[model samples]
Target: MLSSSMRHTRPRQRLINPFARATARPGAASSSHPCPMAGRGAATAAAAWRPVSVLDDWVAREARPISLRQLMVFGRSLTESRLISSANYVRTELPSRIAHRLRDMQQLPYVVVTNPHINDVYNLYYKAFDTFRKIKEVKTLEDNDRLCEIISENLKGHLTVIPKLAMGILECRGLMNPQDLDKFMNTILRSRISRRVIAEQHLSLTETYHSPHFSPGAKLSESDFIGEVFIRCQARDVIDRCARAVTALARSTNGPDAQVPAVHVDGHLSASFPYILSHLEYIIGELLRNSVQAVIDRQAKLREKAVAAAAAGSTTSTTLNAALNQPPPPIEVTICEAQEHVIIRISDRGGGIPRDELPYLWSFSKGPKSANRLENLGQVPRMAATMQELHIDELARADLKAPSYPTPPPPTPSPLQQPPSAATPHTPSQQNSLSSLTSRPPNLRLGMGLPLSRVYAEYWAGSLHVHSLEGYGVDAFLQISRLGNKNEQLTTRASMDAV
Candidate 1:
């Protein structure tokens, strides 16, 4: 929890928002708008500028912890007065949360602070803090509208933050010990999750308030959303949905003809719980994708070894062909519902991770050895942003709520089947969005998925664990709290004794 206290505060200065200015020059002809070069120059100038004081008085303030039940209670009976109150609460609360995080970043060691990716993230936090700090109290509907636009833009701008932080930390792995490194990352990531919840929740509330179907004092169901959160989310539905989407991603990545394994969902199939939809989708999708990929790779490797042996006359051609033609085993997902938590186990026969890679499995630093070759991979993949955009099919993109999953795409020629001249490389711009599903090999393996998925799980007092059986397979256990009363597991400034 963040506590409020006043410190000696520096005089406030009016800040110029270059992005806003360049895009909103009043009464100027469209031709007179600043060119790209001019905009870049403005951005550079903004980047170089910082306030005299890094810690605002608000940094010491205390804010109440948010709970799922609280959100539902607030959302159920929203009137004009309640909306305005919510707006003001959000307006003040966001900066306070952001301020504390900014302080946490400020306390980092100089070496860690100077890492390029960390520096970029630090600047982003500062800009967001400053932007929110400058906004006058949001009291009216029009004021709330402007605040929503700012929130939306900031959310988009911070999409790459998780990847950037991971990359920077990976580069600085040696500077800090594993314990401190995990501490710092846990703090930052949990803070990131908290900030997004407040901003996104407010945005959703505003949207609901303005919807044509909205009535100020009418009865609203508990199922009525405060944001992307669902009060009574169906767990099995999310798991099945994410499984299908990840299957499509696998097919797209490994080529259309890839034999992606089927996902078998069992145990507590009708379980419902209160949770954020996107968060659940992201965690489940990442775990399933990993399992699916592992299955595909293991099967392919088996076929290769068998074929090589057959060529060496150690095995018959008939036996080799039969092995190669067999379908990979299905990925098994079992959901067990308990009084306080929902436990999901995803088991895959994808030949478990090697012993050497286990130490760095849930780390931001000490990523996969392949991470060193990131220059060829463009930027580290955006985890949160990409997860938000994950879909089972093209049609799902159009209607995320109540998604109508379209028929899976028909198989096309694999690279080996196609003529050599037919395969072209995908550019970074084309592969950035998972919606494209055309990422080049190695770009998708930054080693952030499982670690970040753990963060999302732990954010709600849930847990994720993976157990490998070496040559046989791997099992991932995910526990989510259905109670929805656990306060966010946040690290405060007082806890910043380490790196």
Candidate 2:
């Protein structure tokens, strides 16, 4: 977590508040105000000058007002001292004016400062400046009371708001779900575009390193590859631009009424493909659409409930407005690397899949057991036909084995039997023709994305695996041999050219 305290560390010279000198004490004489040189004589003048000099030193040391650097140092010292309880109470009770200023200061970046004694001095400075500011604001008794009341209210409000905001931000960025085929596809698609951009950028950088006219045969090292990867990873503007493109597409399809969706990328080298980049953009768009629909559905349900509740004069009613005001759960993305594969997981902390239906989650078929039973019946007729064919073949073979007995009597034809015909052996051309017809495989149905992906992987001499944890998440993995150096170089060159 990023610390808010680090912001409060600017030099006192930058403080905006003006300092005022303290007033002198009441006069003891008409011509001079307790001047030892004239009242007590020259002997005590040197001693009087000594006190003034000491006072001058004190004023010089305390001249500067409070600053952020002092406050941070103070806060850190208090933390180190294990005075958290006291520090927290003070932070809460701190005057709104001072606290607000401190907050503003906290927004600035500062280098970390150590030194416990200096920190203590810094804390004292902050406390003193806060007290001074309060005194300066207090023009009347009523104003003081009002200031106190306002500070009290703000402190209470902050206690609730700060933690919630922190949690929301964390939820927005953290990873929670297992990686599945959808995730892999999405990642792969996004990575493809990113890789292309990276490759282009790499080419630009390569030009800076050496002229393109230089030998293409020059050996490229691993450092070059790693450097390119690092640059792509660190390029925030590029990533944001890609995300914006995705968001725009999603909004165009889903409409202006839809909420802005969160987008994240994950995985290692496997997820860094050129094709995966586009797929990721598309998947994100679809997921955002689904989320919008879910929200709309929930709202409709709530409105209906509210209407019913109003008619019945019931106090309890779940309405869209009420739900909209409530905080929604966070979305998360997790990235992990394992042997020969990478996993990118995403999860939304919304209402999960129903427990009762979990067992059928990964089944190609869905619905009740009766429906499955009905499906089995459709296969029974085919099985019966095959059994009957086998029985006929067996009978024919038995008859041929008992040739002596069979010659005595001609067999009676059954209703199911066909008249005998002359047997004709298939010629070579006919056999080849039959073989060609039988050898052709059946056309598969479309939208079998998982199987299709597996086929693609196998085509590249790789493998794809998937597992879904119902009501939880899904996990997917793709395994492929590491590209050889020569192949990698070729790929790099091709990628650069495409870019």
Candidate 3:
């Protein structure tokens, strides 16, 4: 049911991080690296004090490169030390007063932007540092700044090259706290959108099918079907919980921009479709959660900028106000029934999936860019080895058949000839021992819920289907068979009697 626009072109492969490759190579010479202590003196300082060169060799020798794990550890260590150490020092030291200013601004009702030039400063430093580190070529601050400016001005050119991992980290910490409930609401919206799209697509595919006949008089008495009601009610409860979770997430991330959308159904008539109500509710919840998170992430960056602007005593509050005033993303759900099947659709207004990446959207394996990066980092070999082991185990299990139960012997007539000895008589505990050997409930295992639901539905001659989008949402459907001819005749007679 996904749109063709959701398909994204495959991104060009990135160059492997040579530093990672160098670190992994066995017997690589560690001695060629310059000593870290040699960079202290002044004139020799500029030449010997290349931070990247000194750190790279030290990291290579230590067998730990600058990865996310290393960064987290470094940050924790810095927080613990607290002292103004050379390790944590930036070349351009901002005034300590700036920290006090930010702390005060945090108490305000809205975000404060303290430094408009902070991004420029970091960009300048990164250019000089990156060129020196990556190419092992020395460059002046002026040269680096010009190059950085050029790249900055053409930001759209580097969209694909920008690491998604880096973006995720920035969104998590620098943007907004995701733990808030409103952030989850957007996720539900997304799920609803996906379901709507799928449902509409399915309807279009079978337009020739007749509309389903509704039998209003065929309702069962409440007392006769209490157990069935309880089961259906339990499913409804889960669906309601999912809806609340999505709403919370959306509100938290959207800040003042969040708007809770009203849920609409084409009456409860479609509830007659087997499993449709439960599946629709649950999947809508999941989609809304994803959408809420996406909106929160997207808006967090803007909020950070707003905060920074407010801190700087800038009078231009228009940008921040505009961002806060924006409306929440839309999620739509639609349902229709056909003679053979019922269809449900959910759609979202959030940015659609990229065109080229659609082929692998439903794949269980790593996403396109992530998988490519993993391969480049030499993780594919280990992953392949693990997969092989799993396959071997599966094959072995498939070769073994289940053992058959033995038939019981007929009762002997001689048993009535004499009373059994009381000393060897079986007790209640002994009699119940065989009962304990029976299989326990299967719901205890992870990943079995969907399959178990499918099994129960199938018992009544039904089929279950699940459709999902990684960054978008999920849709689940169940279809039950129609009643047999004799049952239909009986139902008509019963309907006449009730009338």
Candidate 4:
């Protein structure tokens, strides 16, 4: 299959968000059932079944910083419990849990905001809350599919708010009480993580819900139980696509960047494992975007200093010559594989994240990327997207077959359909149809990418780590576990003591 990166380079009009497409019409050639298929087939009516133990645990853990470790455990425990039961069972259990989450998120309005960025955080909580409420109403496979559609339509807008919200929380920390702030952060973080897991499990169950084996009389196998929650993913190609997307952003025509920075890709890259392609695509693009932004911004700073030196007549010829002669180091990615895991290391020497910033690096409440200057923060991501579109248009116009022979782009990878390989380019009809389903390009304003990527990695028992030296560079480590047992039943890890 073609890497998702190649798909983003195609000359196509922008869509609201990728994954917003549904097979406009179900195919006539296939005979299949629809919605709520396979898992344990049983149903229980929704009830106000709030467990006292859960409430007690919450009350007991008051007025103190909540460890991230505890949230992961709680989130995973909930997911495991849901996955063991049927779609109907999980749906019946949703109301009380969602009610608790809604109460916590409802408190976001009380938090004070010192800047528009902080307001972004205040608003994203509302976004999450509304999404949670809608999710609670999903009691059937059809409802689950509809919920996924709704999320796709809203994902880009919500994502655009993440970086700003993350920045805002930190900036407004002074205005909020210490205990309130910690509880707020903990509550929201745990809620997001839990909702994410539940959403995923529902999607999985809905995928297998219609098969004959899902009927009450027929026994379901492990494969029928979980369906394609995980699959063999082509990892190297996804990274390649992300790299090209980064390049397109660098050379984007509609952005403020007047000069392009050099980009290079090297090392062994071809590898595959059982995984979710979209999650990997999202994680990689976000990380690479951070690297590209740092490199370009640093390069711009050096240029400004050089021009200033020349204007002031203060530069010794040797210093100017040396500066002009040396090229910036290329951002590097190294991928290593093992029987059980894939390790990807992305390194950049474009100056490290500041020391003071390190303390807040992974926190959603950390300061915004533009806290010192928020005026242009929102415009930054839009500009990058615009720049990418312009670049693709230029490429199309410059092609030899400008009229009837524009070079075709790669096909979008789809979960419900087969995707053509990169070597055999997708036809224009297909491209136009599936363009919206393509993986999204890198976002420049997304400060939450690192933390979010970790979520994606951890969802599959993988990990993401950031190691940086103040003046030198940052190295991000991504370790993804190999294929899970194809026929294995869904269950929580035997030992979830800590990450």
For model 4, residues 149-195, the per-residue Cα lDDT tens digits are 55444433444443454444555555555455544544444344444
The true-versus-predicted C-alpha distance at residue 312 of model 1, in Å, is 1.7
lDDT of 1 by residue, 158-272 (tens): 8778777776666666666767777788788888888888777777666666766667766555444444456777777777667656766777678768898999999998787
In TM-score terms, candidate 3 sits at: 0.28
Q: What is the C-alpha local distance difference test score of candidate 4?
A: 0.44
Residue 491's C-alpha lDDT in candidate 2?
15
Error at 323, model 3, angstroms: 2.6
TM-score per candidate, in order? Answer: 0.80, 0.27, 0.28, 0.54
Q: What is the C-alpha lDDT profile of model 3 across 367-478, one tens digit per residue?
A: 3453343233231111100001112222222222211111113221111111111111221111111111112121111111232334333433455555545555444554
How do the residues 1-499 of candidate 2 rate in per-residue lDDT, one tens digit apiece? 1133322323222222111000121121223321111333221221211111212222222111222122222222221122223222232223322332222222211110111211222233235334533433334434433433433333222222212211211222112122222232222222222222222222222222233223333333211221112101111222333334333433443454545436454444223221111222223323332333333334445556766776787744445357444433333444444553334444543334346644533322222342333333322221101001112222323222211111112232211121111111221211111121111111111112332344334332345554444444334454432221111111111121111
* Per-model C-alpha RMSD: 11.2, 34.8, 30.6, 17.3
Q: Which stretches of candidate 1 lie over 4 Å from their true place?
A: 1-56, 370-373, 380-383, 386-443
lDDT against true structure, model 1: 0.66
Candidate 3 backbone clash number: 57
> The CA-based lDDT of model 3 is what?
0.28
Residue 134 Cα positional deviation in candidate 4, in Å, after optimal superposition:
12
How does candidate 2 score on lDDT?
Answer: 0.28
